[model samples]
Target: MSWLGVQNLGSRKFTCGHCGNIVASSAGYTRNGSNQRIYICSHCGQPTHFDVNYQYPDIAPGNDVQHLPEDIEGLYKEARNCVAASSYTGSVLISRKLLMNIAVREGAEEGKPFIYYVTYLADKGYVPPNGRGWVDHIRKKGNEATHEIASMSKSDAEELIAFLEMLMKFIYEFPNKIPC
Candidate 1:
């Protein structure tokens, strides 16, 4: 079997979502006749499956954000995986948690209300001034997901992820990349 012209009969490149490692994958076909191939990451032993004809099955696209603390990075990656799996509500919640994680990492105290973290980040200049609007949007949407019966759409989740990515880049990536 082959996907994206990479043979599934042998070792292939794969990114493990659990540990965020890009390494060779051990491949195997499921016994069921559905033609699904399971690829296990050699480094972390996490398994991901792809249909025989599915293309672009990569879990980790690329690491564009730099200098993120490990915990924050893990949350962001898990949020991305939730987005990929079409779990929009899950993605939004994860993004919300990522926001709180950022706030705490930047020295906000834990155990406060969720909005407290949001306000702290904005007040302390962790997030850009104009970006506070969407930061609140993420918080509101995440509340809906957690407290109400509302379900998040793909577009909404993607927008939140985009905003979160920008905030990460601004707070962690860009500053670290600039010459001191």
Candidate 2:
């Protein structure tokens, strides 16, 4: 029941449902067949489609806060994939192992190529070496599991996922600093 199908309202614009950004039509129009408006955001091209009747009020520009909801979603998928792939290798321990590898791979030359990733962030002044406690225990278990000393259990995998959720949040909040 709203005729505010227009994307840009001079000082206002429609917010994208996909990325939550104000959308402005880039040569887009309302179709007669469906009457749905189709357009892309001036920032992210996340094809926004919505009912033409939807009304939007005068809204101000976003504060430009960095958003990582999609990134977290991706990490969740990646964590699931990592869990699935490493289940046989170390189960939930894989999450811990990945964290350690991420750290070691970033820097801590006492390790190995881990410094490559860490150096980039270090140079950017974002590598704080914080919250790395999970590495020690997980690495210990992972090493044992990999060498056939023991096998990681389902509980271990679940714990790893929980741990990963924290890491994912870190990356979401400070993506450039975290370096995946």
**Candidate 1 C-alpha RMSD relative to the actual structure:** 5.5
TM-score of each: 0.68, 0.37
Candidate 2 has what TM-score?
A: 0.37
All models: lDDT? 0.78, 0.48
Judging by TM-score against the true structure, name the best candidate.
1
- Stretches of candidate 1 above 4 Å error? 1-63
> How many steric overlaps are in each model, in order?
0, 8
Q: TM-score for model 1? A: 0.68
Task: Give me the overall lDDT of model 2.
Answer: 0.48
**Tens-digit per-residue lDDT, 96-166, candidate 1:** 99999999999999999999999999999987878789889989999999999989987777888888888
Q: Which residue pairs collide in model 2, if any?
A: 92-157, 104-114, 105-114, 105-115, 106-114, 106-115, 106-118, 107-115
